[model samples]
Target: MENITFNHIYTLGNIVFENEIYKHYHYPEMLVRYDSNFLAFKKMPSIDEFKAAFTYLRNYHMKHGQSHVKFTFPENQKPPEGFLEYLNDNDFLYGYNELYEIQPDQFPRLKDNPDININPVTAENLDAFLTLQYTFDEEYGEEFAKQKVALHNRNFKDEQIMQVLAYYRGLPAGSVDIIISEDTAEIDQLSVLDTMQRKGIGGRLQKFVMDHFPQKTIILVADGNDTPREMYQKQNYQYVGFKYECIKVFE
Candidate 1:
């Protein structure tokens, strides 16, 4: 099989990343998806241009009714000369400090992270997961929870929304999902509630997931959670890349 280079994927007709890499073109374009972390990209547009890109991308995904987003930078080189200023002017948020990626191969054992009793959850545990999602949201997602509730009510004989669930101290603590792609698995909706902060419940569950699927590469987006991000780093996963906050504004 031919290796799908990032450039080749652009032949699908997307050229935002490579186009921005060129110094000559000031074309500010972006690629975004909100189902994951919110992220944005663009050439060196003006401060307003950056803001527009930032807002536009976020707005697009918001219309999709996504809850959150994360922006990431892809580079092996040192930080750009004016990267911070550019980000600040554009409302692009980052961590309290520099961010890093984490892997489970390095931190393989869940026994060390925390005592999360992990398992593959099914219809039996759907309601519990929704309850957890209800508490995880900043401003309670009633509508989102309605959507989640509808998900729980699904009775698909042939096809259904796939999910994974984990229990911490015999209660639901975290989860990652099985997505649409056959080969690539998207880690969706991993949450460790505020009441359970600093317990390492999320870590142990993630370890169990990684250990379960050794052949697969895990991809998840971390928000402002330092513990989760730190846990990922201690495990040795480097930041492969990030997506943009995708939004489409009304003309």
Candidate 2:
């Protein structure tokens, strides 16, 4: 696996500000996506600097009708001394994400399943794809789901993106979006229905990517504290790096 830094991670947003310290990304179209609207540090800041930065982010997001503030640290760096304690004292929810990558051949052979079928999203299956995604997005709210569906519709027209849905017994059970680049394909937003868990739907969806992108490295970011990272390790994905991030939501 290559040195998969934050550059390999894709987001649907534009950078609104930048300095030696950090960059601010804002996507007014999707306020629900915290990943698309936040600050990313280029290096660690002192607690006083962090307080000022958080204040700035909090005000910026509030002015835009957002209810949260988020910040991501540079990859492969541990939090500066007292940073986690500062976040904890300030009521921010914090965690890190583990980046994993596997070459096509590195992926182990998965058991063949006759009942599960995977297909790329096309005009014929676009509605099914959107419906399945909306089910997952609706947890935030109906308006957020509608906005996400609109975003997905826009993504469908982009040549660099491929969205796929997994079917079990002819019903949409899971889906994932593949962001294509010259030498890598990153899997984003991989999801399976609550009723469909533990039936290998997620693995089948991943296998679909591995088979289709045999020449490119397949990459994904898993919650470092979550069980899925363990599964990724068991599936032979190499853990490349991690980044610490935290978010605070206001009422």
- For TM-score, the strongest prediction is 2
lDDT of 1 by residue, 1-251 (tens): 22211221111112223344221111112222222233324333444554554565456546655444444333223234475656555454443222332333655554453456666656677677667655654254355455544443442121323456677678777665543233333455566666776777666656665676555455555543455666666577565543222222222
TM-scores for every predicted model: 0.55, 0.97
Candidate 2 per-residue lDDT, tens place, 155-218, comes to 9999999999999999999999999998899999999999999999999999999999999989
Superposed Cα deviation of residue 203, candidate 2 (Å): 0.9
Per lDDT, the best of the predicted structures is 2
Q: Which runs in model 2 stand beyond 4 Å of their true positions?
A: none
Alpha-carbon deviation at 7 in model 2, angstroms: 1.5
* Worst-scoring 10-residue span by lDDT in model 2: 1-10
Model 1 regions more than 4 Å off: 1-107, 112-116, 138-162, 180-183, 198-200, 223-225, 241-251
